[model samples]
Target: MQRYFVPKEQFDESGVRITGEDARHIRRVMRMNVADTIICANNKGDAFLCKIKAFEDQSVIAGIESVLTSESELPVRITIAQGIPKGDKFDTIVQKGTECGAAAFIPFHSERTVSVWQKEKSEKKRLRLQRIAKEASEQTHRLLIPEVEPLMTLDQLLIFSERFTCKAVAYEETAKAGVQSGLPSLLRNMKAGNSLIMVIGPEGGLSPNEAERLKQSGFLLCGLGPRILRTETAALYLLSCASYHFELLQREVDR
Candidate 1:
């Protein structure tokens, strides 16, 4: 079934009211007609099995047939704190990261990050990333739209890591085998509701002193694998590993 996400305000007491780009997509792109059954989700993870009642220029009204709680969210909430990379790689990061089920993203300024976000550029990039996140969320049928938070410094990221139940910083300087290291075990052992945070640095990677500070702040220094991965690649890789371990592995075990 085709799925669409609408804002919470679009849902009235009776059903959902689709307008703007969403209305255009349903009417013209999807070519949806009256009495057609489709899935309509509010931003908060409430999905309704809806049948179109009316289609018009300004709005498309649909009656709620049934509402189901969304099961698309991951068991472990994973947040990626990535050091802002140069060029348009951040777009790739936000899109793929959303698909991999990231809860939130933090683009931080690290020592070696080639791209600098001054006042105006920072807001522009933040807005651009946020729009990418929204599109990616709709494409993936995600219930909650992951946020592309404002840029932070390395120190800020370290401080923020304290909020997570499990926190790890990806550092190439850490003297350990990437996948074979304790990282896998640590991730696997996390309780179902635990929130995980993974930190990925820029092109040159996190500085030694920065890594040490993160470690001192209680973040495990883990390696991705023997071969080094790019900044954008690392964020997706970590989230994928986490989803496989926590969500897919448990589902397989239960069956």
Candidate 2:
């Protein structure tokens, strides 16, 4: 079933009222009609099996059939603090990161970050990334949409790291030094429901001074294996490993 993330106000005793772009997508793009079933998730992260009850003025009124029990989210809440990469790489990161179960994304500017976010176009860029995260969430059947936060500076990123239970930085130098134990050790120490913030630098990667500052701010400098990954690949790699450790591997252990 097609899924749409509807705002809380859209739901009532009768059904859900989906309007704007989503309604257009359903009406024109998907060519859905009355009696068609779709999955609707509310602001509270609850998904319901809804049946289309009516369509009027580019709006879709879907009646709530039953609440869906979705367990697709990862046990751990992982946030990717990615240094703004060039071109459309951030878009790909947000989309794939959402599928890999990232809770949120924070794009920051590091010393080595080449892509500049002009003040004039920052909001527009952020909104585009947010849309990507939302669509990817729905497609992957995620209960809650992953957020794409506004771009921040290194100092701001440090403050943001305070909110996470664990913090780590993907450092190429660490990988070069054959330091492979940091990431696994951090994961082993973390439990379910823990929030983690993984930082990855942009194209040229973080400078030594920037890495030192992050380490001083309590971010672990870890390696994603011995190979050096691109700015976009590093974040995805961390998220994939987190899902395997906290969801797939844990389930096997429980069994």
Candidate 3:
């Protein structure tokens, strides 16, 4: 069934009320009508199998058939702290990262970051990314949409990361130095439900001084592998490894 994310307030004992573009998409694009079933998620980690009940004044009301209980999220909450890359690269990151089970994203201004955000346009750009994350979450059947947090400076990012259970920075220099144990070692210590923040630098990567500051702030410095990756690719790669360790390997361990 097609999935739509509705605000928690839109849900009630009877049904979910969906409005705006989603209502139009249901009535026009999907050609859905009363009695047709679809999946509705209340971004608070609850989902329902709903049957279309009524369409009124630009809204589609779907009666809840049953609650959905399957899980699609990663075992650990992973937040991608990306140094704001140039162009539309961040869009690709949010979309693919949501599919890969990232829980949230934080775009940061690093010493090597090239793109500068216009003060007036920053909110607009963030809203756009938020929309992309929502659509991607629904498409992937994610229990909740990954949040696209406000853009922050490197200092602000490090401070914000203080609350996470684990923190790491992906430094290409470490890869070049042939240090491969950091990430795996970190994952070995990770437990289910812990939150992790993985920082990936922009185009030129984090400056040596910036990497040092991160390490001083308790962020582990890790390498993706021997080959260096573009700023955008590093987050996806980290998420892939996390899924492999927490989801794939955990199943084998369980068996």
Candidate 4:
């Protein structure tokens, strides 16, 4: 069944009311009708199998049939803090990162960042990214949508990331020096349910001074791998490694 994320307030004891874009998509785009079954996930990450009860006044009311259970989320919460890159790359980052099980995203202004969010259109861009995150979450059957934060300066990102259990910067220099233990060692030290914030540089990568500042703020300057990866791919790589260590490896241990 197709899935849609409904606002927490829209969900009641019996069912949920889907409104706005989702309702339009259900009624007009998907052409779904009454009695059609769909999966509805609330903001709190609870999902239910629902049957459409009615389409009224730009809304689709669905009655809860049963609770739906799935273990699709990452055990560790990973947030991607990316230096602003050019064009539609950020969109790809948010969409793919959500699919890879990222819990949040932060677009930051690094010293070497070439693209800046213009003041007049910044909110529009942020909303677009938020929407992308939501759509990606629903498509991946993720109960909670990844949060796309407002564009932040380097200082703000550091402060915002303070709540995470661990923070790391994807420094290419470590990768070039044939250092391989950085990322793996960090993973081995991490426990399930920990939150991680990964800072990735934009196209030209972070300046040495910026990287050093992050290190001073207790962020690990870890290399991703032997080869360099584009800014867009770095977060996905980290998330995949985490899934391997925390999910895939643990599955074997359990078996």
Candidate 5:
């Protein structure tokens, strides 16, 4: 069955109203007609098996045959503060991060970050990234579309640390300290329902001063592994590790 996203306000006891572009997609793109069965998610974590009841001039009405809660979100909320990389890396980050179950994404301008975010260009890029996140969320069957915040400087991100319960930053130098000192351990130690903030640096990775500053500000410094990953690669690595550590493997451990 085809799947589509429906707004929360459009859902009720009667049915869901699919209109505008979505209606066009159903009527034209997907070519779904009246009496056709499809799935619709309201972004509030509710999935409904819907059957097309009426097709109006500009809208389509679908009767909810059944509803189920979306269970794809990670147990712990993870917010990734990634150092904006050059080229199409940011788009890839947004798409993959959403699929990996990141609750939110922040593009940071770290000391070693090569990409500069001017106001107009930054907005343009953020919008594009935001669209990618939305599409990825829908494709992955995620209830919430992780937000991509505007670009922030290193200082700004450090100051924003008060927003999360647990904060971790990926530092390559820290791996040499010990094996338990990696991202997997940090995520493993996180309790359910905890909100986490992970910081990933740019191409060259976090500078010594930046790492020191983060440590001084109460951020837990963790390593990925012995092999150093690129700026774009680091966020996905941490996200996948986080999902496995907090959502899958951890749950089995608890059982």
Candidate 6:
């Protein structure tokens, strides 16, 4: 069944009303008619199996059939703080990162960052990324859409790291030095429901001064592996590892 995320106000005791782009998607794109079943999720991450009740005034009213209970999120909340890269790489990062269970994304400007987000274009770019995250979340059956934050400075990102239970920076120098246990050790100590922030630099990578600042701020400088990864690959790699450790591994242990 197709899934649509509706605002909390649109949902009543019995059903949900999807409007605007989603209604158009259901009416014109999906061609859903009355009685067609679809999944509707509210802002609070509650999902319901709903049957289309009516189409009225550019809206699709769906009656709740049943509540859905399934775990589609990772045990740990992982936020990706990436230095702005060139071109559409950030879009791909958000799309794939959502599928891999990233809780949020923070795009920041580091010393080596080449792509700058001017004030005029920030909102437009953020909106595009938000759309990508929503589509990816629905496709992946995620209960909540990953948040895409406005671009921040390196100092702001460091300050934001204080809110996370654990923090790490993907440093190529660490990989070159064959330091591989930092990430695994961090993961082992992390408990369920903890929040993590993983930082990745842009194409030119982080400057030495920035790395030192992050380390001073209590961000672990970890290696993804012995190989160096691109800015886009680093975030996905961390998310995949997190999912395997927190989701797939835990499932096997439970079984």
Give each prediction's root-mean-square deviation over alpha carbons.
2.1, 1.2, 1.0, 1.1, 2.0, 1.0
What digit string (tens of lDDT, one per residue) describes model 3 on residues 79-196? 9999999999999999999999999999888888889887788889999999999999999999989999998988899789999999999999988788774888888899998999
In model 2, how large is the Cα lDDT of residue 81? 90
TM-score, each model? 0.91, 0.96, 0.97, 0.97, 0.91, 0.97
Expressed as tens digits, the lDDT of each residue in 1-255 for candidate 2 is 799999999899869999999999999999998899999998477999999999988799999999999778888889999988999999999999999999999989888777899988988999999999999999999999988888899998898789899988889998888877477789889988899998889999999999999999998888998888888898788888888887888889998
> What ranges in model 3 sit over 4 Å off?
none
For model 6 the local lDDT of residue 180 reads 76
CA lDDT, candidate 5, residue 224: 82
TM-score of structure candidate 4: 0.97
Residue 217 in model 1: lDDT: 89
Reference-based lDDT, each prediction: 0.85, 0.89, 0.91, 0.90, 0.83, 0.90
Q: Report the poorest 10 consecutive residues by lDDT, candidate 1.
A: 173-182
TM-score of 2: 0.96
Error of 2 at 74 (Å): 0.9
- In order of lDDT, best first, we have 3, 4, 6, 2, 1, 5
Reference-based lDDT, residue 144, model 2: 90
For 75-107, candidate 1 gives per-residue lDDT tens digits of 888888988899999999999999999999999
Which residue pairs collide, candidate 6? none
For candidate 1, the TM-score is 0.91
Candidate 5 lDDT: 0.83
Is candidate 1 or 2 superior in lDDT?
A: 2
- Let me know the TM-score candidate 5 reaches against the reference structure: 0.91
| Count of steric clashes across candidates, in order | 0, 0, 0, 0, 0, 0
Q: 11-128 in candidate 5: lDDT tens per residue?
A: 9897999988779988998988789998888877778899999998999999999876766898888898998788888888889989999888999888777778887798888888
Query: Least lDDT summed over 10 consecutive residues: which range in candidate 4?
Result: 181-190
